[model samples]
Target: MAGSVQPRQLALALPHAESLSRDDFLEGPANAAALSLVDSWPDWPNRIMLLAGPEGSGKSHLAAVWAGEAGARSTTAHALTAAAVPGALATGALVVEDLNPSGFDERALFHLMNLAREDQAFVLITARVPPAAFQVELRDLRSRLRAVPVVTLLPPDDRLFRALIVKFCADRQLSVDETVVSYLVTRIERSFAAARQAVELLDGEALRLGRPVTRALAAELLRDA
Candidate 1:
């Protein structure tokens, strides 16, 4: 007994898995239009498209899907510069995400748009607010973006929320049955972001306690919320 060895408890590594495949994305009234617009690219009414949605509304995932199909380079607004425009345009397609006008570089964006037009390339712009709401000092840039077709993703419905919960759980390697799903769907905040957060908390708590995900566990986690 004195020489007996205790089992080694290796540190758990949470898997980083995010699949942006088109098939994996859930469809509903809130995001149907935005998805449709992404699928209709190159043939788009304009070279530039504005995708607006709340946080965790799947705009970035949708953008990733579109980038794959269009062979576009994906970047954020803050990373763009006048010198980066020509090289980015060489890709023939681009996706600039999380564009906040306040800290955005006006001259760089202005040149980017001009170069995009000259190259006949396509650009997808994503943000929490619509482009029209931005206070762009450059009149031409504002006009150009204002005319770009805008697609907004609204909040998820019951069906979509449930699907997201299941997806999030599965992504984190957590097995959740219908009971857990039913309980959380009714009590959790009505958003994809909330679904993701709940699953993360539950998964962490379950791992810490060596317990399975269940309705009771979910209740304990959501109780404080």
Candidate 2:
């Protein structure tokens, strides 16, 4: 019998696509406003946009989309310093994420913003809080940050959280029961990361115990978390 298409060969042949594409995102009231900004960013009237959200709120996910859409380069604030910014800013469309944590390269960031505007390129930024939260010494940089329209992703609601689980299970080809689903929706933290953790827990436990997803099994798995 002919060997079917090799998995490795098939994988390489398919074009690589954006990781957190619009299709992979979940639509719900919790994140509607932020989603709107991300989906419409390529056409945004401004050259700069800010995305703010707590951990697990999908800020990075949307930022990745912007990088792909704009064909821009991305880096953490830590890797960028004012001295290093000219080259980084050379890419008109760029993404700087984890601004507060990634070394907060304010000088580079400050210059990059101006460069983007002058070059007619887009710069997308994501952080845990609004620009007001950052301590700024550069008057112009502070004001530029303040001027950019800010988009925030609110925490996910329970319904959206559940839908996330279902999406993951479908993606993983795992068969989950309604009771198991309901149990997790209540017990897991109301966040996308929680959904991911739950799936991993369940998958591991199911494999260990050789059991199908059930309320009791979910309870057992969650209890261990």
Candidate 3:
């Protein structure tokens, strides 16, 4: 008993870099339209566009891909202000991400849209919900948001869901096979967030237990979850 080494007390929280490049993007029916719009670029139906999707639905990934190609500067809706609008669009392309009705400045956003129109700059706005759903106090801003072409990303289907599980595991450098993947696909929620979560949990548990990732390990880890 005295010579027995205790199991590792904690799993190291190692960071993993996720590629947001065009090549790393996983295309599927859920995101085809959004990907197409990002690829369309300067030829967009409108200079200002809204990308609407649920959390972890690849909205940021697609935005990053577009930003790389368009030389766009990125800012969050909460960080946007009337004073920042001019400099924000200095690159002729800007990404205003995570727009929430309660948090962002309505006047500043209105000014941004107006200035972007006048300067012919391309504005890509990302939000969890469609902008029309925002309880905007500014009538003009409301109208402007409605006029902007909306591209929505839907939940991943079976094929994409499986692909996402594999990619997420790969991102964490976790070696998972079809057995583990198949087990997870049926057990976890059908969304990007779920796949990412499942992999992170498996990775952490595997590290803590000093066990290889496999169907048996996954079952034991996820049995209570």
lDDT of each model, Cα atoms only?
A: 0.88, 0.76, 0.92
Summing lDDT over every window of 10 consecutive residues in candidate 1, give the lowest-scoring window. 7-16
Ranking by TM-score: 3, 1, 2
Q: What is the lDDT of residue 59 in candidate 3?
A: 93
lDDT by residue for model 2 (1-225), tens? 598864431112222232477788878887888778877867886878888888767788788876777788888866777776667767667788887733576677877887777788888888888887677888888888888888888887878888888877766667987887898888878777788778866766776666777788888767866
Candidate 1: residue pairs that collide: none
89-120 per-residue lDDT for model 3 (tens digits): 99999999999769999999999999999999
With a 3 Å backbone cut-off (N, CA, C), the pairs that clash in candidate 3 are none
Q: Choose 1 or 3, whichever is better by lDDT.
A: 3
Candidate RMSDs in Å, in order, are: 3.0, 7.6, 1.4
**TM match of model 2 to true structure:** 0.80
**lDDT score, candidate 1, position 140:** 91
Clashes of 3: 0
In order of listing, the candidates' clash counts read 0, 2, 0
| Number of the candidate with higher lDDT, 2 or 3 | 3
